[model samples]
Target: MLARLGAISLSLSMILLLSMNYGSFALVGFLSATGLIALVVLHPWTARLTDRHGQGKVTAAAAGIAALSYAAFLACAHWKAPAWTLFPAYALAMGSSPNVSGMVRRRWAHLHDGSTRRAANAVEQVADELCFLSGPILATILVTSVFPEAGVLASGVLLVTGMLLFAGQRRTEPPADPAAGRRESSPLRRPSVWAVLMPYALVGILFGALDVTTVKHTTSMDSRSAAGVLLSMIALGSAISGLAFGKVRPRSEPRVPFIVSVAALAVLTCVPLAAARLLPDSLPAIGAAMFAVGIGTAPVIILGTSIVQACVPEARLNEALVWPSSAITGGNATGNALTGWIVDHAGDSSGYWVPVVVGPAALLAAYAGLALHRRTDDDCVAAEDVGV
Candidate 1:
């Protein structure tokens, strides 16, 4: 129940906050990038707090703060606040965004050991995919069909409610570990961790490009009204994969699925490019292509995350999880900047190719990371075998 509420809260908040007047896509992108950087910098600290105090307390506090930020955004919209003021406010809100998915996975790890843990992780992944799939669609309906600010209002309510509920979940809190809480591993010293993080960073770039591509394509097709529907399709695809993964028996070779998923993503990214040629001028065609892309996305994320969790130490799990999340944020920033520039100069048609190029690059990076990760430790297991 708490997990459901938490997901609803985040979904509501993102739909409300992001769907607002994005006067300058470039500015919004830059601000988002800054916000992601802030999250990255603060993630380890937040994780440390969770480790020491409890995941519930930290998550609730973060969600509550996030709720206030959404409320502030509602105020800004009402008053027609200047960009200067709004940007900082939005940045602060984004920076403080809860790493809810990571926290949930950590709890799953805590609840189950060995194979059971992997199954739990898979369930969590499915939950995340379902949230992503549903959250935006609901938010979009409320914002577009009802009122622009309705999304924000809904988000604020959900955040406060969800976080409070999540905090109350007996199973959600991290186990008390004074020693683990006090222990610190200098991020700078871990070259092995960096190797895994680099590819994940590339994946983040893909995320950013994808975000811009989706928005630009939908707007260009004059189907901005259906943007949420398009995004939901993608999320649905992921949720399906996650559910299937959870029920499957563990595999001995996790990298195989990871590599296969990235390769599929690379192929799927070309859908946009293909749409440009095949449909040439059809909005429906573009939407169809996007749905296809969504079909290929979920397994990649779920498997990639599972591998990362399996590879990292239990003690450093939260910190390790933050790297991937930060990489995603960094990618978003880069994609937004690049996409914004392309849209400004070239036209929306050119924007379609960005993911086509980035996807392949990400595939290569993922393969390299997998190879390197395999060389590190004796107990380092494959993602499939670990059921991650």
Candidate 2:
């Protein structure tokens, strides 16, 4: 959660600085995409290193590099460096920051299995929502009240501190096998891998679009200040539901979480879409509907993490884990661009359609991969044993 908070806060600050320097939203989008692209491209290699070396060793080293990269990026921005320099510097900073949330989840899987793991996943999801809830607000406050570069500087400190603290937990850290990558083939070869990741990516679409639409909705309503309140409803509902969802033991059926959450999402995502039409100008109605939709969001994530854990060899788990995140990052970028265009051309309310469409696509992906999900039982099983 600290990693998420730091990464997001830093992204927001850099975005603001870029906006100040360039005065072009297009350039802001480009730089943001560059950072995300570096994450998607570089994380697999880092995860592989984590599997081969150790989480503490690998993440600590990477975080150190990330902190230095952040320093360089900030220096460049502060000195009013040329427009093109920001993209590469920001990309390095983003790519080098450890995916600490993934590492933490990896640790949870190391500690628990079955129902206990489910509960742990819930806690992580709650923490994640809380980070999302607060990170942007924190960044906005620091940038506005303190200084233009204060947000960037603070986020770097938090990230390095979080990684160092997490790394120091030597007793609980998972043992890294130096030869695992050599012995086990890459998890990327499994066709069912995409099956597992695609649904989650669709979930990302729902979330990414939800955020953009929420802000746009507030803007259209002529109450831009209420945007944070509306988004808080969604995050608050998800966090509450996540705590409750963890207590409900999932049945033995393998596809239960995968199929069920997507189905719920398919139905629940429509609530906001419906509210946008039925109560066009009612912020209370929209906020209430958003909270309702948020109720179904966390389970999809909680179980989704569990499903990923079940679907790959423990030896290759870290690398396999990065794929879902890559998929989500890409999906979020897609959802943002797609919905932003709609908000600009059609209407702010029309932005909800992207999620509505994305929900059923996820459902289809869930069912389409049921056989694969059911057969993927023990993560420790040899990678070669997972049949195509």
Candidate 3:
């Protein structure tokens, strides 16, 4: 949660500063996407090293690199650096950060199984929402009260502190398995993998578009400061629903729930567009819309994560888990860039369509995953019964 707090804080926290520096929404989008691209580039490699070396050593090293990157960011802010310098530093900051959240999920999978693991994942999903729940609010307070650089600086401190403590828990850590490194096939070879990750990427788009859209909308109302609080409303709804959703164990495969949740997400996402159009002057209405839209978030996420966990081999678990995250990163980059462009061209409220448009694609991907998983499961079940 701390790790996600640091990562999520970046865009909103430094947003005003980036606007001051670049003076263009498009540039901000490019820079944000660039940073996420760096993260995507490093994910697979980081997972491989974590598998080969051990989570503690690899996470510690990544955290250290992230610290240095933050230091570089601090230096740039001090000097009032140009976009060229700030862009790369921000990219490095994002790229170098450890996959602490991913590590946590992998650990959960390592430590638990079956329904226990599902419940654990559900709880962890709530925790993930909590990180996001507080992250933006914290970033807003620090940036508004302290300084623009405070958010990234705080992120650095939290990243270093949390990762070190987490790594110290040696007994719970998944043991290093160098032998699995010799496997000939890659998890990427499976089509089901794409089925899972594609929706994740779509979900990423939802988040990214929502981030920029809310901020821009609030900014339009001359309440830019309230952006964090409004965003938190969305997170609050997700966390609340997540707690309730976590209690009920699904009696069947997650396919139906996953698809239904994704479908709900796509439909609810359109509410913001309506709110923006009808209640242009009403912040309360807009906030309610955001909260309503957020209801579908945790269910889609928890189900997706659990399904993906079930799909992959234990040996490649870390790597497999990281892929959904990377897909989200990639989707975020795309969403940010696209929505940023819309804000620049169309207007902040019109930018609401970005998520609306992406929603169906996400739903379609979830449906495809449900179909693929069922087919594969049926094939396996048939073979097993015949063998018996």
Candidate 4:
């Protein structure tokens, strides 16, 4: 998940900047969108590979492909190569991401059960928050202190080293499942899978828009430097809550936690808008709102993923896990593009509404999942009962 953050947050701006240098801002947007699209399109393939070949081998191979893509990127930047090469380089690299978060969650499911798995998920969520909180800062420092390509290079190295080390932990790896290949049909056909995925995509939109909107909002207040700081506070709040959440065993099934967390998230997501309206000049107020939003975010993810772990077939676990992330990527891209437009025309303050509107969409998705779970209660058992 930490490594995934580097790709999502760190190398992202670097890729955009490199693309912009190659051609126009249109190229930048195009590549960024294409990279995300490629992730959605190619992610299922990686899941299939992971399930069939084992996580270690697939991850190692994917990291290698990503490394080579970065190498191509470096060569292009060095020689000032054609701008078009950037497309393939980025597509190949992002397409080869290996769904690190999904793999980690799968392992957690493999090793733990019930409240322990929930606790483990919480721990992973905390790690995820820390990664987002620290990864971008690290990348920014490296880029500014070293070179333009420094962040990408560092990420590439980390990708290789980290995946290699992670892959080496054979005892922790999930065994290859032959059943994953039995059905050439995708997991998208499963209503249970899509129920979780649809809302997650909505949540992803909230995430992506929240990011771009925060930057715009901070810049509008002439405190652009505090944007990252404010965002870090948000992540900090989530990490703290994640720790607390892990310790307490929820009295209900995963669905209840999922619904409540998302409902809280939907409401808390509006706080930023209120802050923007009421204290237009106060970045701190906006930060406070972001912190609240963060608090709700982790539990939603933790419970949602726990439910997904329980709901999907063990053989198709990798594919099931990747769907939510893919939906997130797709939704994030949608939110960024849409909010960017809103920020340009409607104004920065209006950008907050993007998340506001999308938050309920996420809630609706959660409710859909709950409804589906009610209808097919037997299908949605505890993770331990599923015995993946």
**Whole-model Cα lDDT of every candidate shown, in order:** 0.66, 0.75, 0.79, 0.75
Q: List the residue pairs that clash in candidate 2.
A: none
In the range 330-383, model 4's lDDT, one tens digit per residue, is 887677667766776678778889888888888888898778767776656754
Write down the TM-score for model 2: 0.86
- The residue-by-residue lDDT of candidate 2 on 1-388, one tens digit each, is 5667887677566655665566554455556667777888898899999988999898778878988999999998888888798878888998997678888888877877766766787898899878766776676567666877888988898888888888778898889988998898787666457566878778777766776677667767776556556766777788889989877775444356668877987898888889989999999988898788788888777766666676666888888778887777767666655665677667878889988888899898878777665554443332222210
lDDT of 3: 0.79
Clashes within 3 Å, all models in order: 7, 0, 0, 0
Candidate order by lDDT, decreasing, is: 3, 2, 4, 1
**RMSD vs true structure, all candidates:** 3.0, 3.9, 3.2, 3.1
How much is 64 displaced in model 3, in angstroms?
A: 1.4
Q: Specify the highest-TM-score model's number.
A: 3
* Maximum-lDDT candidate: 3
> In model 1, what are the clashing residue pairs, if there are any?
204-331, 205-331, 208-332, 251-384, 251-385, 254-383, 254-384
Name model 2 segments beyond 4 Å from true.
Answer: 11-25, 75-83, 219-229, 278-283, 347-349, 371-388
Q: Candidate 2: how large is its RMSD?
A: 3.9
**Reference-based TM-score of each model:** 0.87, 0.86, 0.94, 0.88
